[model samples]
Target: MTTATAFDPMSEDYQQNPFGYYRAMRHEAPAYFIESMGVWALFRYEDVVTTLRRPELYSSRDWINNALGEFDPVPQVPSIISSDPPDHARLRRLASKAFVPGLIKKMEPGIRGLISELLDEVQDRSEFDYVSDFAANVPVNVTAQILGADKTIARNEFKRWTADLIRSGARSVLPQEELDRIHRSVNELRGYFTELIAYRRIHPGDDLVSALVQAEEDQQVLSADEVLSLTFIIQFGGAETPSHLISSALWECFGDPALLDAVKTDPDVLPLVIDETFRHVSPVRFLGRTTTQDIELHGKVIPADSVLLSYIASACRDETVFAEPDTFDINRPGLSRHLALGMGPHYCIGAVLGKMMCGLALGMTLQRMPNLRPVADDVTWLPSPWVRGLASYLVAP
Candidate 1:
């Protein structure tokens, strides 16, 4: 008989060393069932790659919300990520029109400037918390400005809300107080976007909300909730993931000296280093979906109505995909395809732009900072089971 895996995810020493546990799962149970959560986790690269691409067959239908009976993964407002089809297509076009290529291109110089400034403040200090002082603030502030919100107000508020939402959702069940708080935040977030949309409608700025409001004026349109949903999605998704990725990437460089030296010396290796970092140290770990019909994989059937969770972080380290699945090799090839931003119809809208942000900010960061290394110990994880990022990485120059 196969001995069962532990029930509580946090019960494992995963926080201390998760990769070793993931590697074991790759062989023992590639398409294993997480008895604790009553959800199935797909660990190997091949399985994850296939599942992410076939949102049609697997059906992102109710899956986007990642539901369990009477429990909702997201709040009431449904964004494109939670949608499939003609609705998904329509919403994408609406959002895409606002998320213009020209706007992203314009963001490049500002990112470089922000990175330089952050590094400067840290230079005088022997040790500094990288995430709090630098990584966490920059992306969200930029996203808020783009989304037509006041950066200062949104920055502090957004960070608290996102972090709280994570802790509340990490469990199979949340307390009533937690549930109440989540709902309260959701209402506030909606109202917050409602006000911003109103402001953009009259004032008209170069930001994304102004662009969406103009789309409405053009006889192209969206509902009040849809507008609010898109705005919330843009600000939260854009801010959370990229900031997590940057801090996590820096942590990888901290542990590996040779990789650090190579990055310090070579400008050409920047892109690959970023790409590999996505694979090695994933920011968002698992996202769930409730399958509408039965599915078969690895000679096992996942019955319909089951909650399927993709171990996105584990997939990146699948031996079948990368040469040294766990190593942070700056020159590693096969950079073209990575699900770090996800895939298919609901692929991350901010992906290209997020990549641009990472390239510019991290590139500029290491360039000016000079001899930057992790301060080691006293670094803190956000206490999020979902986003595997530091609350801060103390840095010393």
Candidate 2:
């Protein structure tokens, strides 16, 4: 097996900008083994796709659990993203009903109004950290709206919980205090959802959580644990990814003068810009998978039970599949093939909602502020192994 140069995802250098490392790994060792993490990372698009397509051979039962450090008292149940076939399929099918494109489209009017309101709050300011002032707020509020928790939970409180929950994935490398905070966040989410689930039983509302609480198919329904598991993942997933996506799109556009000019001139290019941002700035860096059987690729044999990390961020920038992979080109024809939202049966359930939020937020923001631009040349990236997003993106209007 090819062993890549000391690969530590926890390193600050790698976390800041992984594209350079991804580029080297793609060429030198497509399937490299990281000794420290005991994981074989697939950097090539072909290899990543092959592994993602065959979940039976490469199970997901413990992938997310391994990525997100396990809690001490709280048992990690198999959620949709962390379950293998049959169970995964069942969970996805039932959970997906709440996220159907039609249902998400129904949320468009409300989401647009929400975005407008958020923009209004920042309108008078000459500059604002888009990540905090706007991007961050959009997803949590949308998630609250979806879960029917808007009225029960305050916006700032929900935002705080979502931020802490997303960090739970980095608990293994985090400081003791930070780790404890993440655990608290986990407990809070569990407690909140546990109570919400119980309350929803009495007062079912037209929200995703309520729907999942009562979701039934083929005379089979999701248990309370199942509902909690799905809600936990969906809550954060729905909150974190889209926020990063919106900020990343703005970052790319403002940084590229020509792209920004084009966008300003032709508003229709906004969708293309967002799609390309998904490829250029993949929010979720990589997803872990456990091998069910021996698999040979790139002249190496990966043993069963090995933690295989498919760097979808790397796959999205695979030179073979994407021409000028590093360059952010909105017109890239292969935009449809990017694995930012993931691939296979475990694809993001909130994909439709995510794209809509991004497009709406960006389109509205740019339209409202004709002179929007970046406040600095550099961005503060989130220092985490699981995602690639700005810690704060300062922008001026």
Candidate 3:
């Protein structure tokens, strides 16, 4: 609508601190096209929410396939994230059954125990990387437990596979060799899930994989490919987003003494603190969609099949939505309005699980490490266009 802007997401300045860039886009170009990325970027809260909610108008199917031209083969199994109704509806319903409230509530004791054990292992160290020592492992272990994965699958292996899979999915332009590596990682991850699914079929357990194995839709069960695809989505979604969230929440606390003191003094506000963190520093920065039909938005006409990037991170900080949008205030009113977990049909299926893991991780960290503080102001962030998270955050107790 406004004159298109040259927004380079991969630029050093944007990667290091995107909030300023996001603010600029929200002000100057709510629906501006990024010449470099070849996608129309939506930054306003209302615009992003509308685009996400109206998936019928803006489809996700093969959006990445179109964007990743000549890079690597398009994924064979389109997960729920990439599907449209009635297929999307069917897959989501079946998957939702696995993450019902009762099952997640049952996971609390195990989640707390895992957090305690991790804190114990790091308690002796004077300084440690929050991401590696704590944040990264929690979700992988939790997801593994929920999926009834073989304990033989190393945690580090899970982390590596998940990270590669996520990198492979991003719109960022990566080198050919790196893209090839990502492709190989994708195959390895698929093989792992295939083997896991086969085992679960023969020896079913009270876990998500087994549930998906038996999940029926109108007298039809999910195919092997469907199960594998869903497994891939669940593993990465459950692991990466929540891990980033835990680290981001802690990063916020460590950077603000008053915030840290508030949480340490009144742990009751831990959930609110986590919510505020999600609003202020959403882990998943943006999601891609394709225009299903030519549409007019904010005085711009986006043609059919054009790629559109809905910047959730930017929307969460929209001045129109939140009072003091940039401030990390736990008690900010109407925090639920934030689109951190997305909205409408494709709202993150793993939202509840992510919250549980993050809440426990933060609560336990504050309790166990009473003197928790950042080791340095320099934090290394994961280099990806879509995911906003630190690769490592140095901290000391």
TM of each candidate vs. truth: 0.88, 0.94, 0.93
The collision pairs in model 1 are none
The C-alpha local distance difference test score for the whole of candidate 2 amounts to 0.83
Give the clashing pairs for model 3: none
Best by lDDT: 2
Tens digit of lDDT per residue, candidate 3, span 1-397? 2222546887766777788888888887788877776878899999899888888898878654653433322266666888878888888988887788997888788778878888888878989988988898888888888888854474857887776666665636567888778777767777788889999999998888998998886787788888887887788778788999999999888878888888887878888888888889888888889889998877889889888899999999998889889898887889988899989988989888888789889988988888888888988787767788998988888
Across residues 210-322, which tens digit of lDDT does each residue of candidate 1 receive?
88776643466877677777777787788788887888777877777777676778866667777877777778776566566788877778888777777778777777777
1 or 3, greater by TM-score: 3
Which lDDT values do the candidates have, in the order given? Answer: 0.71, 0.83, 0.82
The lDDT, on a scale of 0 to 1, for candidate 3 is 0.82
- Of the candidates numbered 2 and 3, which has the greater lDDT value? 2
Best TM-score among the predictions, by candidate number: 2
Q: Model 3, which residues run further than 4 Å from truth?
A: 1-6, 63-74, 169-176
